[model samples]
Target chain A: MSDTKRFLYVNRKAPHGTVYALESLEVVLIGAAFEQDVSLAFLDDGVFQLVKKQVTTGIGVKNFAPTYRALGDYDVKKLYVERESLAERGLTEDDLMEVTHENDDEEDVSSIEIVDRARMAQIMAAQDVVLSF
Target chain B: MKFAVVVNEGPYTHQASDTAYQFTKAALEKGHEIYRVFFYHDGVNNATRLTVPPQDERNVQKNWSELAEKNALDMVVCIAAAQRRGILDEGEAKRHGKGEGSANIAPGFRISGLGQLIEAGIQADRLVVFGD
Candidate 1:
């Protein structure tokens, strides 16, 4: 196997109420330094982590939702959001924050990819390391 | 195959530690290599040697220590998480000006930074995380 491995970070929980979301994001930022192929999958309640208009002011917690937008700058750009998860939660692509990364080859092309649960499972099975949080 | 396990919850209060323990044991039984078992968040509590459970209950700390000793596994408790929860090894205790007696890391477990966890992810064939 190659020394450079593909890493998939699986997010299955919500951003708040637990440390998993924020802590997982910390890991992603750190992992980016390794320069390995890193992709993030937001499923189930994890989709909430990318939801737009996240207002935590009354809750007295720093809103970390903006961090997702910064992932592109770190070269961690493959963000796969499960379609079923969003639908089940009564969410749509419009409900999530716009996570875009400037394409290296074409500066104008930038988008977040949405996949079905089956596609997500395929991606999970193909990863060299699946770090779930 | 080489595997790295991450335990994200403490003992007794959650089944995460128990599930990780069982999975590690099974992987060993199948002759798979364990690259590392990283304890993060509340999972650092599993490294404490000070836990005293009831006689009838399984000592989660003891189980992990024994398993690590038997398999020569690298059981690392995240230093950041451990320090936050008072789960210190002798070296950390002394370095931090805490008495040696304040250290509670069980045998075969080490205290390290989150870099070790990221390293485990890079090196292992599979990185499995057990959490609440």
Candidate 2:
């Protein structure tokens, strides 16, 4: 049997209200070390997790939004932000934090794929494991 | 078929745990092999032995423990989530300098790292997540 499995993490909740976003990131980071084909889907209120310029000073909780930027260091590069989710929230790609990872084959290339709902659903259906939070 | 179950909510407060329990029971009755039941986020709370429900109410923790024991199932409580929520096992409580009695893990449930979750994803034929 193949050791590498296609793993998709479906994130549908906003950060801070509950521990789902932070905990989901924790799982993703851990899963990256396992060398699986890991992909993250940010849809519904989950898109708010990647919104730039978040100030948690008033919230008094440690702002973990910056950790998403570090996912690349762990070799977790596939972050699929749903286009419809962004549109529904009146957000554009410009509103999100710049998340990029150096391509494995090419040292200089880095990118983040913004997919629509249909594409995201397709990706979800193709995964060997679908972990939703 | 091998199945993996991920519970993302705490007992009583959310119906997620109850639903997951019912689904697992049904699957087991159908002779499906349960690879593992991973408790993440608030779901870790389900593994605590300290939960005290009223006499009339169903004890969700007990129900899970009994089911796991009967089926020889692997019920894993995520270590990180458990620590954050104070669901310590005997070893964890000792290593963290918490008192021996500080560990309140229920029977048939073990504290494990997130790697187990990933492993389950790879080993199981199906992975079903239950959450609010």
Candidate 3:
């Protein structure tokens, strides 16, 4: 398994309305088991998945928002959030929870990055495999 | 070229699975290798053997089973998603407290983890996803 292909998971759905958001996260967690270059791109309504204080008690579904915070522990650290999507939804970076990963020095580095539309396109175009959810 | 397919929607509910089946069939017809076919989310419904579609219409589940048999395709249904949707093989049905020998999984499709999809993407030259 020496192949180390670049994989980009493009998510463009809301968190609870449908299963795409959770489905995307599930793949990201499992994909972490492989020795491949993996990155997550959140755009459109998908930005709502990273919002802080996600409570699903009223909906009777297990609130899985906390799982996003633990993704870095599995080496799935690159999570890109589009700035245009955030603005379109009337939100700012402060509305989302902070996700961080530890470096060689054991210092925690922020994993959730807010990137512009053009940079997001570049990141996606450079991938060997792009799976849209 | 080596190809991998991901079906994110169910059989008749969405055209994703049918489209994926056609694409895989066409690829094979053109002499392309199919690495695997991973079913996720509601797409797990495509692996149910108990489904009885109308005689006049196309049988989605039956179509996949026949194609897999003909092509020797590796059709995998996400274990987590299948359990959530009540689509289980013999082992899963027994472990989940169902009656004796109660199994609903179709032939040629096995219950597996999401890691299979990652492996397909890593190994295949192209990973095609058909979904809403």
Model 2, A21-133: lDDT tens digits are 99999899888889988888999999999999888899888799999888888888889999999999999999999888887576633346789889988998888888888
Candidate 3 residues B1-132, lDDT tens each?
Answer: 999999999989888988999999999999999999999999999999988988999999999999999999999999989999999898988887998767999999999999899988988989999999
Native contacts retained, all candidates in order = 0.52, 1.00, 0.95
> Just chain B of model 1: what TM-score?
0.97
Q: Give the TM-score of candidate 2.
A: 0.96
Off by over 4 Å in 3: none
Worst 10 residues of 2 chain B by lDDT: B118-127
- Preferred candidate (TM-score higher): 1 or 3: 3
lDDT of 1 by residue, B50-102 (tens): 89999999999999999998999999988877887899887889999997588
DockQ of predictions, in order shown: 0.61, 0.92, 0.88
lDDT of 2 by residue, B28-112 (tens): 9999999999999999999999989999999999999999999999999999999999999899999999986888999999999
Give the clash count for model 2: 0
RMSD (Å) of each candidate, 1 decimal: 2.3, 1.3, 1.4
The number of the candidate with the highest lDDT is 3
Model 2 C-alpha RMSD to native? 1.3
lDDT of 3 at A119: 98
In angstroms, the error of model 1 at A56 is 2.1
Instruction: State the lDDT of candidate 1 residue by residue for A43-98, as single tens digits.
Output: 99998889899999988887888998989889988999999999999999999888
Clashing pairs in 1: none
Judge candidate 3 against the unseen true structure and give its global Cα lDDT, from 0 to 1: 0.92
TM-score on alpha carbons, each prediction: 0.89, 0.96, 0.96
* lDDT, candidates in the order shown: 0.89, 0.91, 0.92
